[model samples]
Target chain A: MNWKPDKNKPICPQLCEHMSVLIASGEYNPHDKLPSVRDMAISAGVNPNTVQRAYETLEQQGLIYTMRGSGRFVAEDVSVSKQSVKTLRFEKTEEYFSQMEALGFSKDDTKNYVKEW
Target chain B: MSELLRCEKLTKCYGTKTALDEIDLCLESGKIIGLLGPNGSGKTTLIKLINGLLTPTSGSITVCSEKPGPKSRVNVAYLPDNSYLNNWMTVKKIVDYFKDFYEDFREDLAYEMFERLGITPETRLKSLSKGNKEKVCLILVMSRNAKLYVLDEPIAGVDPAARDYVISTIINNYNPDATVLISTHLISDIEQVLDEVVFINNGHIVLQKTVDQIREENGKSVDDLFREVFRW
Candidate 1:
């Protein structure tokens, strides 16, 4: 994924969301090791602390697990992660709809517009 | 979180001219912080005091619980606002000097950076251009694996490519337990990498907040907020 830290959006949440998507798509299969915090931070052009916060968020959701000092890895159970991916996709869709509505787009019109994707 | 550095009512005066007023600040470990303000806004004064170049007129400042002096200098890697290397010295000699003075200096990293910047070890400091001189200074400062890395306007007066190189070098280095205090007016260039920001104006701290908190509260970038806070 071509992801660079965007100053406009809060970096931690954006990274967390991106990692979740990758996990859900099986790009990072179950039991795969995630990039270390420092590696992710450098590649993303952000502070390691921000990356750490993002990793912690993923860990809390059970999408990733830590083996003490070894490193963080994708969770073994795929079903739980798939469910979270569904919820996250739904949340994003809702956000897009709400934004369209605020911009004067009707629900039916927004549905038709999304169909173009 | 452990307190890596702290200042209490820190005041610095230059022959009755108060450069830094009564300022109280604290920096915790494991974060990248920006010290930002306009020119003559006490940004450099604060950094200098922290580096123990200029002693405080009143109050006190400490690094790792030790007062700022030779003792604290051990843990602090400071980059001054100018080309401090002797013009007659070769770049290789300067690297050796850094290795001698700073126990944490990494020769391999210095060589790697110099290679990327096309800075030959035998090149004299006086022979290099202003931009190359700045790059050398940045390389020397970052080569040290110090606990407190204090950089002053590291990206200023340099080209965009050089700025990107310096910022990336800083972001990749430094241990998680270390704290980086960067003093610069170029907010937009460095905002994405900053975990926290301290805004100073006329020798006083106007604000200190995490980048995420500031964005959540103001719905704008730190650069916009800085302009708003310090607008004429």
Candidate 2:
């Protein structure tokens, strides 16, 4: 998918994209505490408000947790982490399979392609 | 006991520009304080100063009787207007981090939130769509058991459906004894839950009153008053 940055797009979208990559790549583990808002804003080169929006977005998704005084962190659940990764990969696989089918690739051909890989 | 938050002649400047002009305010616990203002009115600047994210040019701000610092931060849960998560961490990793850092964090609540939102821990922050990311952030902030919760713009950019969820989460999750200060230009959506509303114009607080008092005196909703006070 083409993920070009649009100036009109809010900062939350961009920040979320960065976070998604981190989570998918396993750079941050489950139940790991995140840095402060000020620190993240400075590092991301965005306004604190924008960073705050992203954190809120993340919270709504249940991917991270925030503590009153300490700061935001990754949720603590291995099963959740596995399930999230599985869902993501499954969705992508479904998309690819659907696209291949649309291009007239038969099931046999698809199976052969998978085997070749 | 002293007020939960006390700001006495607090001033903040950005070079030659004065963002907050000697503002004095007191916030008590168990109340939802709405910080309302127009664009460039320094509402955000004042919030930053109180949270210790920005130093005031003059005057002082006290949270629970101590100056705003690491000590004050422990009791304050701040939600800025943007995302603060590192793009590299997985949802599970973020949760693990919170458990380690916050002594009062409840793992069960976090899990319940995940179930409610259908968010899986294995998902990478980058994989989820824009709306889902914001939801993740909201769940995290609301899970904390803080004494003061500062939400800069809890519902700004998202579909209408998601806005309802965000607002509901905030109302349902907030601790009744904690102080919640929400700053936003979108007043109508949040006015119903706010116990008190404070209006700022040109970096100065123009009005501060209880929701009931405002309605009784002005015979208008907080949004209407905001429009009248901030009419350009």
Candidate 3:
């Protein structure tokens, strides 16, 4: 999938979100070792620090685990990550809903647009 | 990370024209910083002062706590905007030159990068294309395990196809402890690789922010903000 985020969004969080989405979609299976931070940064065309931040976020959210002297890996049971992805989806939807609401769309109007969508 | 570079009220003037105004900037190790500004906004002057190529008209700049000179030169690797090597020399000879002058020069790594870039050691500087010359310069600079690396307009003339190769070479080769200070006016092409960015205008620093902070607070890419900041 395309990896474009909002033009100016911080690359770290965007990467975190992207990884979580991938996990939610089962692209990265349980226990899969994610690419090293430096490698991901190179492929993603971003700073290694940014990739490190994304990995930290993933760890904090319990989506990934780190083995000392080894590397980061997907959690053995990503159900927690799956749950959090639901939360993230809700948050993003809420954000979009608010924007549409501010543009004078009612809830039913949005529902109709979603039906059409 | 320790402080790798520092400048306090650094200024440079040529005759009556001020190239750099009083600029106070500090950079710590392990960061990739962009010294961004439009043409003639003093990016080159600032880089020159740090590399000891030009003496500051006023104020001072330091690398690893010492003023830029023979001592600082040991800890700093500089990639100038223009080709500085003798055109008559082969790339291999220039590599030897760096090895002789810099104890930290990693000949093995230079040779490895040379092989990967398909740059033959036998190629003379005069025989190389403009882009190849720039690549050779970068490889030579990266061969050093210096505390600070100063690169001036490293990608200005590179075509889009070769820019990524250049950027990746920069990322892959640097010592983890070193700081890279790249000066350029083009933001979009290199913003992703930058940890922090220093914005300069008319010789004055307008802003110095992490690429993340700039995105979070302004909700705009550095390129967009640069357009707004320097817009006529």
Candidate 4:
């Protein structure tokens, strides 16, 4: 963790996005244990309350599940992680295509460049 | 989730100078709040009133639902802006002094931090570098398991490395059920760690809002909003 969060955006959402990317990319494998709120807070240099909020939202989203006495873990099923990856991929492609279009390159040109590379 | 501190029409005056106007505030446990303001603001006055170092000119202040006195002092750990450590005392002696004085003091935690910092217990406070001395003070304050931790400018006048150490020490040592109120004007350095921020100006509270709320509503970080709010 190199946690370089964007200061312009709210940190909780950024944390959620970061964790989601990690889970979807297999960096955090399915059923891997999530770090405790205090540990995550120290690593991220944010408040524990903020980390707790992110974890609660993550639990609600079904990306992570919490056991009564243990701790939070990534979902056991891989489909949820795969679905998130698909959404992220589409988002990244859309952003890149829009950027290329603004620079006077058509979507076809962008596709050709990728194919050429 | 209980209320840890409250101020009701709290006012403080020095001679004819009004240092703090009547201000009402409440703080709940388990929060890390930032008391942000420029110099000459009522931050110090409010902190003093909370600690019972100075009596309020009028109104009332409470900690754990009781007035600031012997009973409340036991639950509040205060790190004043100025250094209060006597230079003659060795680190070990000071540790003993604190452990004997405060019932909640944790000597083991204090020694652990000292060892991690490579500070020998036998070293005198006068021989330590300025940054190391500040760290010692902070470690002592944080070693106590108090309900409310009031730190006034804990990061001020230290090197960046020491600043990081201070911040991390705070995040690591604080009890999860307690609330911490840190007062500082250097917003950007500690903004990420703050749950809520209270902006005070000229002895009156200007605004109070959660850090995320500020970012989401104002479309800017708390540091940027602080600059905008306190800009001359």
Error of 3 at B106 (Å): 1.4
Clashes of each: 0, 78, 0, 0
For candidate 2, please provide the TM-score of chain A on its own.
0.61
Interface RMSDs of the predictions, in order, are 1.3, 14.3, 1.1, 0.8
Q: Ranking by TM-score, best first? A: 4, 3, 1, 2
Error of 1 at B82 (Å): 2.1
- Comparing 1 and 3 on DockQ, the stronger one: 3
**B58-135: candidate 1 lDDT, tens digit per residue:** 998998889988888989999887888799999999999999988999999998999987888998899999999998
What are the chain A TM-scores of the candidates, in order?
0.76, 0.61, 0.79, 0.85
List native contact recovery per candidate, as a fraction of 1.
Answer: 0.60, 0.00, 0.68, 0.78
Per-residue lDDT of candidate 1, residues A5-115 (tens digit): 556667788888788888889899999998888788777777788888989998888889999989999998767667867988898899999999999999999999878
* DockQ score of each predicted structure, in the order shown: 0.59, 0.01, 0.68, 0.78
lDDT of 4 by residue, B1-232 (tens): 8899899998898999999999999999888999999999999989988899999999989999889998999999999988899999999999999988899999999999999999989999999888888899999999999999999999999999888898888888756679999999988999999999999999899999999899999999889998999899
Name the weakest run of 10 consecutive residues (lDDT summed) in model 3 chain A: A1-10
Query: Highest TM-score: which candidate?
Result: 4
> Among all windows of ten consecutive residues in candidate 2 chain B, which has the lowest summed lDDT?
B167-176
For each candidate, give its TM-score against the true structure: 0.90, 0.65, 0.91, 0.93
lDDT of the candidates, in the order given:
0.88, 0.76, 0.87, 0.90
Mind giving the per-residue lDDT tens digits that candidate 3 earns over B1-232?
Answer: 8998888999898999998899999999888999999998888888878888899998978889999899999999899889887999998899999999999999999989888878888988898888888888888998899899888888888888778887887777645588889998878999989999999999999999999999999999999999999998
Best by lDDT: 4
Model 2: residues with Cα > 4 Å off, grouped in runs: A1-117
What is the C-alpha lDDT profile of model 4 across A1-117, one tens digit per residue? 698987878999989888888888788887899898889889889889899999998887889999888998998775665776788789889999999999999999999999999
Task: List the TM values for chain B, per candidate.
Answer: 0.96, 0.95, 0.95, 0.97
